[model samples]
Target chain A: MDAPAIYRIALDVMGGDNAPVALLEGARAALQAHPELFLHLVGDEDRLRPLLAHTGLKGELASRFAIVHAASVVDMDDKATSILKEKKDSSIRVAAQLVREGKADGVVSMGHTGAAMVASKMVLGTLSGVDRPCLAAILPNMQGRPTVLLDVGANIDCRPDQIAQFAIMGSIYAEGVLGIPGPRVGVLSVGEEEGKGSTTTREAAEALKDIDLNFAGNAEGRDIWNGKFDVIACDGFVGNALLKSAEALAEGLVQGMKGVFKENLLTKLAALLTLNGLKRFAARLDYAEYGGAPLLGVKGVSIIGHGRSNAKAVHSAIRAALMASEHRVNDQIQASLGRLMSQAGSQETS
Target chain B: MDAPAIYRIALDVMGGDNAPVALLEGARAALQAHPELFLHLVGDEDRLRPLLAHTGLKGELASRFAIVHAASVVDMDDKATSILKEKKDSSIRVAAQLVREGKADGVVSMGHTGAAMVASKMVLGTLSGVDRPCLAAILPNMQGRPTVLLDVGANIDCRPDQIAQFAIMGSIYAEGVLGIPGPRVGVLSVGEEEGKGSTTTREAAEALKDIDLNFAGNAEGRDIWNGKFDVIACDGFVGNALLKSAEALAEGLVQGMKGVFKENLLTKLAALLTLNGLKRFAARLDYAEYGGAPLLGVKGVSIIGHGRSNAKAVHSAIRAALMASEHRVNDQIQASLGRLMSQAGSQETS
Candidate 1:
């Protein structure tokens, strides 16, 4: 299969709550599946060597993956500001630096979201014309495809200009990666009607309407999974809440069903018969199914996996990183942003 | 039991996508179930007569549910602003007026949400010290207990004072009505950190930290459905979006499961066996399960049901109204607001 388009994904080995083990296992899984894939495990060499030795890899497989010793690892519980200020040699910071230095195609981290965002921002910097980098999470819709929601946890207090830019980035990601045509972008608001939002949303909606993108005016939160819009735009705070709420609800429902279905003989029988369907449903809702959230608006490809990610989640995250890097999401974002700004300028003059 | 607490819930008979059919049937469901429950159906007499005839209701039900001719109905497709300005004598306005004039114990309208908000504001008025009214919805958690979220769609532009009041109202509703003891109230923000939100949120969080209630610092969107907090507060604009997104996700999951499970013959058999569990899961996530969203800052008992509500939803909404009325939500809100204002006063001085 033409060597599966070899991509080197840098992994922050000591990031998430389930650190090196999950990270090391994930790297192993990715490497086993894609023979051409290379992994740069960024962490203390001593800690990783023992874990890697257990993988029992030989020859080329071992050579393909290497540990780049980092002085420290950013703890998942550390404060974002403190981590950014103090943890320069942390695994997350070093991993991000690898992408910036052209040593890796992308960097994936299961670190504190804020820490990962901060390190990625500091090391790789935001793309030109992008003020802040937004974390875009892909939510599975009924169509079996995914919708990209931006600024899920990045910049909570955003201006209209920033949200407008977020829409552009989200649109590009959805189209460039997800393969949606002429993506419908909607600004998240209270109602679908015009002028039905905060000062920032209202202003962003006005600006978005003038842009060349397939702007669908204001969309309520219900519109996110309704397949009404391909790209849902909002300030990071709202987007983060929506993303998390959706995930939590799905997880809750799945858990609740498991409990309810096992309480009786009839339900147990039902559970057995519905097992495949339930598995499919769980897979559809599983965050691991989609891999990771892309840190859009950044200069380089950076993916943020969940804080509690296991090997499977980390593996999916690496796959997501490969996909994002292949799609050239940043290039599409910058091009779209330029078009949006020019459209706004023309509207002001006309 | 004890005359079932007579509650004259004013119904917007001609509101919603289903019009009088759903509204009329919903009123009948409540009225028939509880003999003490009376419905003041607000809409044109000419249109209502035939609709009632179709229900084949007895003379007792016909007499118990009175049709108050409002001469106009708010179309579901109409703009909120146009509905407010043009439909002066609309069912929503008249229904809200019933609560204002004490003709009805509460008003339940399944019409344009913005129109409902405006009508409730103008007719019912805000609780004495409330600067703005908030639309509060109950989001079902994994634990099966619902969490009340305020500012679902009332005031888009909110100040710190308003959000602080929302927190208080949300707390009271959660405690007094939802039956949570000293409900944990949280301000919805991007981060769990204290000083991480917009200007309004920062001020609101600071104000909330000192409240007598069990104020949990900051909850992200994921925490809303996690049942970690009894009440999650935010500006109406963001609250509405979060509420909608959560609702949409739940609805989408249910719909997706139904379609997927019923897709094949084998799956259909599985669906039948798992039907009870699915139904229970549906009920748990159903918006109608809790009845209606309460207008938090309003003086009177004002519950705004979904615009597309059916008979069961309307019935549940009426029940919600009764609960709110019994709890004296308005009085509690007023008392809470007074405390909040004084607390802010002390903070300002310090």
Candidate 2:
């Protein structure tokens, strides 16, 4: 039916803990899964070329991929803005450049999150009317549908207007990409009441009311996965804490369960019986399932994954990039922001 | 052993989800567990007298407890400062007033947290140099030792000085009450690096260096339960988000496991085999085990438990209040703040 539209993604091969090997394998998996997918492998050609050879792609499939050599790699400790000046030829920068130059539809990197955000913002620029770009993470909720939580770790300190901008971007991303119709947007706070959080949060809640969205007042931290709001917007500092703590808790619980199962023969037998169910449970909480968090408000699709991302995670990230590009999320975001600005402008005149 | 010293706690029996029933049971449990404990049951005398009869505390033990009647109850939806003028006769206020009047050593309430904080601060007032009171929650970490997380929801907008003060108070609480020697204190940030967080966090980190404690630079959200630091401090907004998110995740995971076990007959049998281990796991993550969070920096002990607290949680909260009172946490906090102020004064003169 209407032959699948070709989607191209620039892959930062030399990023994340798994690096080129996991990324190369993920690229292969994505290519195998989607016939219309193409990848620009951005990394050291010497390292990637050999890895590409071992990926076992035949003539037609092999034509779907190419290596774009990058001289440097951004270290985890590198300053977020260092890629702009110091490590200009870094894989993350080169990958974003591919998107900027229209050589690829999107970019995917499981690298230094700060570096990825900086590179994407500097290279592709922000969507029209958007000030600062924010990161939006798709979390699996009890409702089985995904909830989008934004500004996970981008802008540490945000003004009321920026929080409002984040809400609009998050709503658009949720509806346009996550397919949640009329996404319910809520500002994260200490309590669900309008004036129950910090002064910034209170102002943010007020700002959110003036926006053109199905704004659901304030959401508490527990509401993140309680299947209440489709989109929850928070400042990066708070959002980052929640995201990291949730991830660590899930990981720790999984590890604790493993320890529990290994305690005795009877428990071991119980583990065997409940293996599939437990695996499904863990999968629900797994970051790899969601793949990467999209750097929203950027002019182009830029998916940033966890540093500890695996082959499966990389594959999911590429798929996310493809979906974001296909859905034209940035276009929707720009249109939404334009509408908001015009509304404010009209209100001022009145 | 030397005769146990009497520790009197003013209990807000009308607070929490379970109200009088759970509070009565908890008071009984606490009284049974601690021979020298006394409770000033603060609520409507009519409701209390009947419930206290069924508690089975008799003769000398019965004489140890007394009903301190209050006419009004603080509703969950009431304004935090309403108890100051509007609902002055509220159970929570009565409990705190008992402490202020020297009738009780501490106050315990499973009521609106903000109200409890307001009442404690207004009635007992802040310790000598503590300008604001902060909440310190004891979280069970992977290392088997408890980590103290402060400002969970007390002061939403904290200054650099206030955060530094929270660190000092948290360190004291961890050392004095939790019994950790020379508690490792940390400022909660997005990263462990000194310059990695927001302006306030960076400033707090700087302020922490001049304080007299084992300052551990910066601690991330995961560090709350990773057992990295003995005490972690953050603004109430961020800390609340982290605390609530962690609690929800642990709860959601437990529910997920229960669902998995109930899925099939085989899984049910498996659950039967691993019931004890699962219970232990759940217990480890249970808030009942920790009981309550202390409102540190106040002139007297004020413990705030969850609204959903059961008899066990209330009992634990009473025990926490007793420990806090017994250890003279306020004296230690005042001494710490006094030393810091004098140090600052000397530095200014120099």
Local distance difference test, per candidate? 0.81, 0.88
User: What TM-score, over all chains together, does every model reach?
Assistant: 0.89, 0.95
Q: What does candidate 2's lDDT look like per residue over B127-167, in tens digits? A: 88997899988898877678899889887889988999999
Q: What are the per-residue Cα lDDT tens digits for candidate 1 across B6-85?
A: 66878887777777888777777787777767788899889888778677555768778788889887776766655457
lDDT, residue B67, candidate 2: 90
| DockQ (CA atoms), all models | 0.61, 0.76
Give the per-residue lDDT of model 2 (tens digit) for A1-350.
Answer: 79769999999999999998889888888888877789999999987776676865445678899889999999988998999899999999999999999999899999998899999989999888998999998898876778888899988999977888899889987887777899999999888876788778788789779767999999998898889999999998888888888887888888888888888999999999999998887777666877889999887899999888898999889988887888888888888888888888998999
Best by lDDT: 2
